[model samples]
Target: MAEEKSRDCCVRHKKREPDQYRDMINRLSRIEGQVRGIKRMVENDAYCPDILVQSAAVTAAMKSFNKVLLEDHIRTCVVEDIKADKEGTVDELVRVILKLMK
Candidate 1:
């Protein structure tokens, strides 16, 4: 069942390089920890301002993650697709960037 799930995921997603995958995973782990910390703070009645600051930090971390992912996608996926004359890739990329910017 686990192997089947993995295969299903891979079928619809790009296979990242080992280093890129590791970096993305590490960033997500840290973000996950940060979110749990914020939840704990809320449960423990942390000062409102302090919680807000931590929330902003989480937002920044998320933006940083998105920036890294977008750069990698453009460098690898976008470049490869464009080279292969996939015009739709450009449109797809534009739509994605627009959504991200929003």
Candidate 2:
């Protein structure tokens, strides 16, 4: 039988407080709506340049959000783990970054 590992390795960093989370959620929700709008534009055969511009906007929004999350992870999870000398944490972080690049 495969041994069960602790779930902490997969745990997310401590989340921002409720208000902050709500703000982030609201921003993401708007981005989601924008993406759906882009899909509808494509379905309706909108102008190519217009669709391309909207697509670019969505990509930028997603990248911005990802950057914020990555910064938070580095500040909270990575910094703490490194300070405590937790084995393999840095390697795990590097692997995650490589996956993100792809």
Best by lDDT: 1
Score residue 23 of candidate 2 by CA lDDT.
71
Query: Candidate 2 regions off by >4 Å?
Result: 1-13
lDDT of each: 0.93, 0.86
| Clash pairs (backbone) in predicted model 2 | none
Residue 72 accuracy (lDDT) in model 2: 78
lDDT tens digits, residues 1-102, model 2?
Answer: 223345654555576879868878987998999999999999999999999999999988888887887887888889998999888878988998888788
Local error of candidate 2 at 102, Å? 3.7
Candidate 1 weakest lDDT stretch, 10 residues: 8-17
lDDT over C-alpha atoms for residue 42 of model 2: 91
Per-residue lDDT of model 1, residues 1-102, tens digit only: 999999885554789889988999999999999999999999999999999999999999999999999998999999998999976888989999999999
Error of 2 at 25 (Å): 0.7
Candidates in order, TM-scores: namely 0.86, 0.80
How high a TM-score does candidate 1 get? 0.86
Give the per-residue Cα lDDT of candidate 2 at 92. 87
